[model samples]
Target: MSLHTASCRCGAIRFEARAEPFYASYCHCEDCRRASGSPVAAFVGFYTRDARFIGEAPGTYGAAPVTRSFCRTCGAPLSYVDARLPDQIFMMLGAMDAPEKYPPTVHGYVSEALPFFHIADGLPQMETSTVPRPKEDGQ
Candidate 1:
């Protein structure tokens, strides 16, 4: 897989990943919208082990199911990771050096999607969070 490099708007936070993306998607969930200040958010999923911060580490905020890391300088949203999806990290698609490299395959939390906003991309729309919570170890 080709290298994937991304950074915050102020270039304060940067990261590089070598692992192939598990998937790319757009999320219309309220939390995502609130965090992104956009109608929807696009991100590419990769395991945490496959990615790393460059020089400065961004500030992180943990809220229940997920934790988001962003640049303190430019306040650019960077990555979001959910505990339920261990080892997985989702990086904002726009932050990518080559944003076009990852084309979204799905639109998640479509039920929450704004009525005034819709994409004509023809990607699958999931009515809820597409990443199912992992089962217990003994279950």
Candidate 2:
């Protein structure tokens, strides 16, 4: 199986996803913009089981349902995980070793997109994400 590798800007944190990503998108939410320091951010989603840290785990922010992680050494944003989709991890596309291979297939949260920045890719745009999440099973 091919591995998709990624790391922080300083190489202080590394990870690999052993399986194909389930979804990839360009997000325009304010939270993502703030976390990534960009008006738009792209993320590639993988099953949590397919990804693993290469060294010490990265530092994290927020709590529970929506947590963001970053490289403590370089302060580069890394990943985001939501409890609603507990089995998936969304890694920042900019952090990937081969970002060109996993281009965003859709634009998400367009309602929140900055009016000054526009993408004319003609790809599907959604007011919210179209990525599928596993149905919750009562624990």
Candidate 3:
């Protein structure tokens, strides 16, 4: 896949993903909702080697051992990096220059989804904190 570029609202932070995302998901966890100030947060997952950051690396903080990066100037949440998944990164979908290019494949943390929010019926849904297990692994 060809590389795709993305940036924060103010354009102070930019990034590029070298390939199409492996998957896309919407997170309804409280931290996501609070950090994004949205009912849910959309993310596009890719391998770390497949993505690059232009300009300065954004400010980062550990939300656990996992780190969340954001544009300090604009406070736009940009990406999530985890030691457990050292090779992969999850970029905030809203930061994409063409967010339409990546559509969410699933809804996660459904138990924390807002009571008044309405999720469309067709997409797959999972209630657990982690992603669903692959069929063969039964994670």
Candidate 4:
């Protein structure tokens, strides 16, 4: 099994995933843009069971349903977890050691995207989350 590694800017926090990601996408929501301090943010999603944090624990913020984590030392955003998808964790693409390996397949929250920052990638753009819901839930 191949391993994917990611770390914060100061290397105070790190992440490891032993399996391939389930999804990768660019987010244009205000929450994501604010957290990342960017016009748009990209993420790579993995099963929570397949990913883990190592070295130092990350600082977290947000309400119960959604939590965002960052490196306490460097203040670099690291991960985002939503209770709705308990099995998944989304890591910031920019924080990855090799971000080129996981290119975003879609653009999510297009309705909230900054008008000045157009998405010209030709990828599927959705007004809602691009994360595929489990078939069993039929959501």
Q: For candidate 1, list the clashing residue pairs, or say none.
A: none
Q: Candidate 4: TM-score?
A: 0.93
Question: What's the TM-score of every candidate structure?
Answer: 0.93, 0.93, 0.89, 0.93
After aligning candidate 1 to the native by TM-score, how far in Å is the CA of 71 from where it should be?
Answer: 0.4
Query: Which lDDT tens digits does candidate 2 get at residues 27-103?
Result: 99988999999999999999999998787689999866789999899999999999888899999999999999998
Candidate 4 or 2, higher TM-score: 4
**What overall lDDT, based on C-alpha atoms, would model 1 receive against the true structure?**
0.90
Candidate ranking under lDDT, highest first, comes to 4, 2, 1, 3
- Identify the candidate with maximal TM-score: 4
Model 3, TM vs. native: 0.89
- Best first by TM-score, ranked: 4, 1, 2, 3
| All models, RMSD in angstroms | 1.9, 2.5, 3.3, 2.3
- lDDT, residue 102, model 2: 97
Report how far off residue 68 is in candidate 1 (Å).
0.6
Q: Write the per-residue lDDT of candidate 4 for residues 1-139, one digit (tens) a residue.
A: 9799999999978899999999999999999999999999999999999999999999999987789999999899998998879999999999999999999999999999999998688999899889855455564
Against the true structure, candidate 2 reaches a TM-score of 0.93
Looking at candidate 1, the ten consecutive residues that score lowest on lDDT are: 130-139
Give me the runs in candidate 3 sitting further than 4 Å from their true place.
130-139
Better of 3 and 4 by lDDT: 4
**Candidate 4 residue 101 C-alpha distance from true site, Å:** 0.5
